[model samples]
Target chain A: MWETVLSALMDPVNALFLVGGVAGGIVVGALPGLTATMALALMLPFTFSMSPEPALIMLGGIYIGAIYGGSISAILINTPGTPSSIATTFDGYPMTRQGKPEQALVTAAFSSGIGGVLGGLTLLFLSPALADLALQFGPPEFFWVAIFGLTIIATLSAGSLLKGMIGGCLGLMLSTVGIAPIGGESRFTFGFSPLQGGLDLVVMLIGLFCIPEVLAMVDRKRVAKQGLALKREKGVAGGVIKKLVRQPLLLLRSSIVGIITGIIPGAGGNIASLLSYDLAVRFDKKHKDYGKGRMEGVVASEASNNAEVGGSLVPLLSLGIPGAAPAAVLMGALLIQGITPGPDLYTRYPDLVYTFIIAFIIANFVMFVMAFYGARYVARMIDLPADVLLPMIVMLTVIGSFAIRNSYLDVCMMLGFGIAGYFLKKVGFEPGPIVLGIILGPIAETGLAQSMLLGQAEGGVWQIFFTRPITLVLIVLSLISLLSAVYIQTSRAGWKAGRRDAETCDAD
Target chain B: MRRRLNREIGVSLFFLGIAVIAFIQVEGLNRMSAVFPRTLAVILLVLSGILLVQSLVRPPEKKKGETPLASSRILPFLLILVLYAVLIAGLGFLIATILFAGVGTWYLCDRNKIRAIIGSILLGILFYALFRFVFLVPFPGI
Candidate 1:
């Protein structure tokens, strides 16, 4: 492990990939409406020729850098660059209005850096044990795990559960487009010859995530003429380090919250930051300062969101399950590299795993250095016209989709999915669950088929799910996940109704 | 302003059609090939039906005043994308990319013609160099 770490550090090529990924990620995250998932999707084809270690190292840099980069626009323009930075805008924008924008920026950067480092440490420590436990899982357990992932889509669609489930079903249906996994028979090719190989995951990813952003940009071009102006100040970062040191507990607690949330499949950085901010507000003596230029609020939000980077990777590395949308893209990257991430990942490629983990830690530090010194210049990226940016992204998306298999069918399929994604988003359905469903669909299907084959030999199909202890645990987790999503939504509605009733009584 | 319930009903109906088509297609397949797709199709069908019913029964939520980004508005851009995909096959990678970028930049930003053309050409060259030289991805010439 030490040798691999040293090799990664000494190698110029590894450093290059890390630097490039971090720079690109920061730009993507700083751009409004661009996401880490889209960036990964656009770049996925580029990693096709790369060795697994370098490919993952580059992705890790992008993941960590993008999470931190979101706070830049959140502080300066009151627009969260990524969904995760939504909480950052609460206090971050207020500080900008107070003429202390630089301070808020520094606070967010430093907090994110600390949080990222802590999350990386948790991943390094916890993943091995998790992988050990996952080794005990059979086909039935795997099926249950996939079901648990599908259930989390309910949580993804908090506002519209029915729509979200439909999106999941859409994804599952699409996943069945090419050929049956077990039977080696075409199911839904519609007589199209090119589709026998299946809808390329990279094509769907770019189409669904990137193309919609471009279309949205064209639509909003008429409204986004005015740009945010940023003024840079020196010496603001020095004080933030001192403040971060003073509030070690807040940083630790927020990091813990982020990691835990990230470990749960489908709960991305946005949820982590929101939960962390709530906890911070509850414990803060300066509660009134929240949503009003409070440094702690900025710290709490940034820390947790960045921390989610490490936490999300834990599941991807251990259980072959994606912890978030970006992680799902990473899992695809791994599959393309012919490296299945599970218990064998630790045994077969320990050195490579160590190298990737070490690179992630190094990337966080690199992000810290770049964000601290180059934020003023980086903030200018926000000013680029949507017209120019959209066209450029379109060209990349077109090229990226075509490059997957050098097929026009893939490109056309991407456009079709892109159009579909745009309509889906218009009606309040998120693209995340759809993407999640596509990624997990095959895993669930294959697991179920394989489990069935094994169960027939063991007397009965029902016995497989009931007899296995691991399967039982997974089933319970799945139920808990699904029930809690519905429970939370109903209770929130009831609470709002009660509040409205009390207000009416008070008025009377 | 469009009502949320109306939009929901429309979406649900669209998905319902998709589900019914999927279900019909999988009907003659072997059990092994049909089980997964058929199960998902049924789930989608049931869910969309529930969504349609709920949308019909619920009171319409207050409509927001902002002009939502409609897919209809972006239909022209989608056509442009289709044209680019077809053209890329005829013109090859670099030439098609340059043409698309230059023309697309001009189309997207109508006022700054010269800047758009030059900047887009540079962008095209940059992408070509990055993909061909750095990543070594294959792109056929015309």
Candidate 2:
């Protein structure tokens, strides 16, 4: 491991490309309406020319940089450049409003650096052990793991659990639009050649997330606000470092939340950041200051979101199941490099794995150095005029969308989704749930169907799933998640009623 | 605004109608095809039912006074898109993109003629050059 790390550090070309990739990713991510997925997709073609190690190193750099870069826009514009930065905006923008934009930038940078390093360390130590454990999992266990991922729908449901389930079912139904899995029978082609190929995940991702954002931005031409002249505090880095040291537990806990959520397939940085923010609020004694420009909120969110980069790789590297959307794209990169993910990855390519781990550690440190010096300049970007910024974003979104596969179909799909997403937002149905459902739907359906088939093949429908302890545990956990959601809704309703009665009594 | 909501309802119903048609189309297939689409159609039917019920239960709320785009604006945008789609394959990416960007910028930029012209030209040239020279992404030469 030490040798591999040293070798990776010594390679000048690898280091240069890594820095370049991080720079590119930061630019892509700092722009509103341009997501990390789009950045990865756009950069994929460039990777075709490079060797595998440098290519993977660059992609890893981009991944980490993009996740951290989103916080810049979130802090300044109140528009999260990526979904993962949504939690950061809760406190980050308020800090900007309070004329502490510099502090927010520094805090975010510091937390992101710490979180990224912690996540990388976790990946380094935990992955080999997890990979060893993954060897014990059979087809049934894999099916259960997929089912566990799908159960996230229950937690993510917005208005009604039923609607969320219907959305998930719709996604699953769409997944079956092309050829059948087991049998070679055509299902729903209806004579269209394109439909036979089914909807591309990248196209769907761009449409469902990016297009809607672009259309919304166009409709509401948000004028970028000029930066407030902050009173230059003594030692900005010292201040940020002092705060982090004061709240060591908060940083540690948020990073853990990020890593755990990231390791779970289907739940990515967005969910991880939100969950961590909630946990921070719960634990914070002075929670009243949370949304009112509290530095802790920004710290918790930035830390967790960046940490998810390393956490997300766990499942992707170990079980061949991508923990997040970007990881899914990275999985494609790995396959393109002729490296298959599974048990054999660690055994055969230990050097590559170790190199990636070391690159992550180095990338975090590089990110820290860049963000530390560059925060003020990056913050100044918030002042760019709306006319210039809007046009630039629109142009980038168009180019980024088109650059993926060089297909016009993708562009059209993006426009369609943008219009649809705008309406979905107006109606109070969040797009995150739908996007997550679409991603996890296929895995869930195939797993459930295969598990059932295996059961039937074994003479009884319930024997295989019920007899296995792990399968039984996962099924029970899924049931508990559903019941808990229902219970929470009911309790909230009851509490509202009690509060209403008390108010009436006081009025009387 | 009422007309817009009514139009949305009509569109959604049309999609629901397609779902039904698809369900019927797959009725004759073996057990595999029959199961998935039928399930999808049922789900779509239920969603449409919920949408219909929600529409009735709570009338579509309107913002204070912003007028829904007259069918005139809607028709033109749709026409522009459809025409671009038709022209893109035959006319090639460069010309089609230039025309599309020029027209789109002209329409979207609040009728600023100079900005529209310059923005469109710059976008077309910059994107074309970036893709063609820097990235070497092949665009069908027209």
Please report the candidate that would top DockQ against the real structure: 1
Instruction: State the interface C-alpha RMSD of candidate 2.
Output: 4.3
TM value for model 1: 0.94
Q: Give the Å shift of residue A316 in candidate 1.
A: 0.9
Cα displacement (Å) at residue A479, model 1: 2.0
CA lDDT of each prediction against the hidden true structure: 0.82, 0.69
Residue pairs with clashing backbones, model 2 = A211-A418, A212-A418
Window of ten residues with lowest summed lDDT in model 2 chain A: A223-232
Encode model 2's per-residue lDDT on A222-245: one tens digit a residue: 434453233446787687788788
- A250 in model 2: Cα distance from truth in Å? 1.6
Off by over 4 Å in 2: A1-10, A32-56, A77-81, A89-99, A154-162, A226-234, A266-270, A320-322, A325-354, A383-453, A480-508, B1-22, B30-85, B140-142
Each candidate: chain B TM-score: 0.83, 0.72
